[model samples]
Target: MAGSFHGLTVFNNNVHAQNSDSLSQADIAEPLFDIEKETYIGTILQNAANPTFRFDPRKGKSPSAFFAEVDPTPSAPGINEMVKPPTFPNVSPVAPDGLIVSSPGFHFNEQNNAMSAFQNALVPPKPNITISNSETDDGYNVFSKAGCIKCHAGSYFTNHQIIPADKIGTEPSRAKALAKTAKIFAEPLLYSPTENVPIRKNARVLKIPLNNIDEQQLRLGFAHDGKGGYKTPSLIGLYWQAPYLHDGGVAVGYEHNYGLTGTLLKGKPVDPYRSIIALVDRKERQKVIKANASLHSVHITGDGHSFWVDQESGFTKKEQIALAKYLLSLNKGRTEQQ
Candidate 1:
């Protein structure tokens, strides 16, 4: 249940960390006390002479803390800036048993700083050629009237809230698959960002704030609502993001093909307008649904989010077209509206 940088990590830790069977390739060259590792430093070198003196990082640590432990060089331009291989940084020369620090507070800040910088440097998408103020306004009206603003609200367009499995009505198994995430859920904690390279004693521990988020909503986002759910995403780049729904199930091709079987799997490019039309029109959705029937067992059926603007729903054909065009007109420099 996080929002900023920390929020994303929390989200990853929940649904991914528990069931991930993957091993670390990078953690091999360097090592730490992480749970599932082939080449952890703590494993490679241990004293066999006395069992008391040897330590596996896991013995004293909680599984909830960090995942992988990496030490990327903090500085640029050459040999001097390279990170020394992670050895027992806290091991004392004379202590009876050398210390083994948990993987959590070790060597993470510099790497996170690098990641933050890369993200900050990214540019927002520019307005597309087809976008126009009048058309965008028309689309906005249809969008609001159609009740999309309910969950896809706010300046960023996502309430960041989970739409329940029953409500989204797409695939429930994918969301329910994450139910085990709650077992590992813990408060997001870290050594303060300002700390030095070798984190010293008395390093400030920070608890990432999960403000404005409902605890149930947060848990369900990871839990997938007991049965599962979909988190509302920002509608910012709808300009060309096709195969519209979460499962990438709602697909409509450039030459009027439909579904994953007919489109993406067959090298047919998706058309943004037609895909959006299929997204809102129940009649077109049936075509997509039937086209994807082969994959329904694997849950790629283009189902759910039953909101519609088709003639059956009383909206005119012209209004439906306007809505599709308007969604694509986003980022043509129109300000974000709720």
Candidate 2:
């Protein structure tokens, strides 16, 4: 309903929202998905903390009133290394923690509350991440020049808006997963920050002010007749968290810098610069995509988001390196306020 993130984590929010949307469960459609009471498993949340990596510690975004999310066993997280693609559902999702999870007063424990605070306080490692070369600095310009900055804009590197399949142009399979959750996804209802976990019958509810959210942009966030939305993720930590794309399939090894089947699965690290090259360089990406296919990896197409930075797009190798280095350095020397 608004621009700011209240609880931020989408799938996790579904677990809590099931409480608020308790009534929706009564009429939930078949296939019995996550967020629907039937699909819920009580703990060990599948959510990752990628969204929290560079999040503003000062503000709380979530399912209550501001956060954005969905069901995608089917998908991923920067919050948890995510990308809103419709990975075919491979496993069941565990529910969010909270005694009164069925209500706004969810994740009731004091430690649970503290954990959230700590998560936002944590920052991605940025030590020596940026290259010392002059080209590294120019890379950011190249990124913006190549239109990478359009969605990957702002302090955390994400505008936090969902881009539909057509414009994004990646393989559309993963979106099939996101579209499913969009059906019953609703704005979150949160208990007042001061409310207790067990939740009183009469408790104060936090008003997640969103009168400032861009209504048009919000509409653009959704897909399939406004049911699903694919959030553009924050590009905070690209150095270590490689094997790019939503499926962790767009991988390349240190030797050849190829695909998931050729790299990470075999315990090799993904060459950041080379892998990034493949991401924006279609010729290179075709090789990587083919490599990912060797294993028939689940949802690992590593295709789409047709933004390129290679010579084919009229850029030089020098500029491509600069862009990759800048992306890797996104973690340091800046606060979320930037």
Candidate 3:
């Protein structure tokens, strides 16, 4: 959408925006919005609120400010950055709300409540006849003892940190997607007119904070020039979400046809339980990777984070199953107690 808007403005017409329909030929095989079960929309907003990109000052302003800048005519890059067409309409620019704002789709306040009450609502299901307490314990033990806790920490099961594509060894395409973002407009133009009079006045700019960041980590986490880092995700209700990883390639659901993509208009259904097993077991993960690579985009590989829990890792088959059961048992709030 940002691409469409930028093409429209920079080219001084709606030709590129109209041409987008011609560009989208493939069927939508993207992951469902019923995501990792911890309010990812909120996480994105928080990331945007941060000043620097991936903790690097060289990255210029954060995504929130960059997209919010409604000034179509930017001077720093020079008005002659592109050839202005004769049909260019002299109209007030629309704020890039669709890029950052949620439409009237989901009810939760994605900008403010991702890590709070909205996240709390994404709990796991209750224990069933097949699941036992001992299984959950074994799973938790395997997760902790295997050193997974170092990164996937806290009640949300994530440290809320961004790691470089190299360190985690995932598909790097999406990480590098925004590497060359231009600072088209300054921060003063970001405030929407909807804000209160005192706060909504034009030309009001607050300097975003740029201190107290882990520079070394930032260096490792993104390009030295400041781009491309994947945020560690929270593992809240692992049972409900299918097609794990930043890319939704590590998916399952087609067999029983019950998972996220099962809705009539969406892609084929997958089994969340089976897909997760594939996530933990390296051999199984390879099969998923192969499948994802065959049909999905380059960014949608199920590879990386090869921390396995199978026999090769010296775990017995029973223990592996136990760990899977324990993972499936994860839930929050009253549902956990039940």
Candidate 4:
């Protein structure tokens, strides 16, 4: 519940290139797991008055092409609250103002667009979420009976809505981490192509739509004033990734409890099959949480989402295992089944 703490709230970017690098975190298999998405690109692209970038891409050295406003002050004042495992290349030489490309018309956008298109083309269409026979008889019935299907509905297993921190309470730090960014967005000196002198008259700025966004949800999603929320991600690829939740605090190794450190280490793989059981079985989850605690992992716990598949929830251990197996077996829903 640290007010100024940010744990798993990272600006989502393509990790493909990062994974190949020797310096990257070993757990490259789990991609797109960060809480936030493309902070810099998300900010300047929108015409929102107070466009802010949280992490100063340019700090001790020259700024990156992506550098915007630099917030020199540390996020948290106390040394005890300082961010751990800091982002790389802390220093860089400052680049020219025009080099901070924020406009859609910037030359880099074409390459970005092309790369995006290529990536999209490379992604195969989502497979149908076909329930196996065993899953239909055992897991799906219990999952539905437990009312899990309400939020985790749809073929992808997500309703794609940002649930309020207060409502679906998990870790609050990451949800509230971006509250300061909203202030940055409101800064009149915010960096963007429009801020550049002799602004390009023909620049094609993207006017991001906010039509359907709920006001409360929007504010909550940013953790503005400590009331932000989190998006329910798709459960489609649960097999390939483990250590559930935004902070990845919930993790269990193949035959033992690896804790949160298991999340960072690619060598210690999280047994997705068992982890799902840990997720819904309260007793197993307690063991996982205790393991995560032993690692001194911050802002993460397998505590919330306590709709258990345990005896307390009138479910036997065998039923819980079956439900976990069913959950693990899920894939993208078949169109014909829909």
> Top TM-score: which candidate number?
1
What are the lDDT figures for the candidates, one per model? Answer: 0.59, 0.54, 0.47, 0.50
Instruction: Please provide, for model 1 over 112-208, each residue's C-alpha lDDT reduced to its tens digit, 9 standing for 90 to 100.
Output: 3444456655545753538567777888899899998888777666777777888888777777754643433344455555665465666676665
- Ranking of candidates on TM-score, top first: 1, 2, 4, 3
Clashes of each: 3, 34, 8, 17
Model 1 poorest 10 in a row by lDDT: 91-100
Query: Model 4, 1-338: lDDT tens per residue?
Result: 10001111111111222222211211211122232334423333244343443334334432222233432222211111111111111200111010111223333222323444554344234332355686557877888888888888876678878787767757777677555434223211112323332234443333333445566665666665566788876666566667787667778887675566555555677777777887887778888777677544567676677677789989887788777777766554534334
Backbone clashes (count) for model 4: 17
Off by over 4 Å in 1: 3-6, 9-21, 24-109, 113-117, 120-124, 127-129, 195-204, 332-338
- Which candidate tops lDDT? 1
How should the candidates be ordered by lDDT, best one leading? 1, 2, 4, 3
Of 1 and 3, the candidate ranking higher by TM-score: 1
Q: How accurate is candidate 4 locally (lDDT)?
A: 0.50
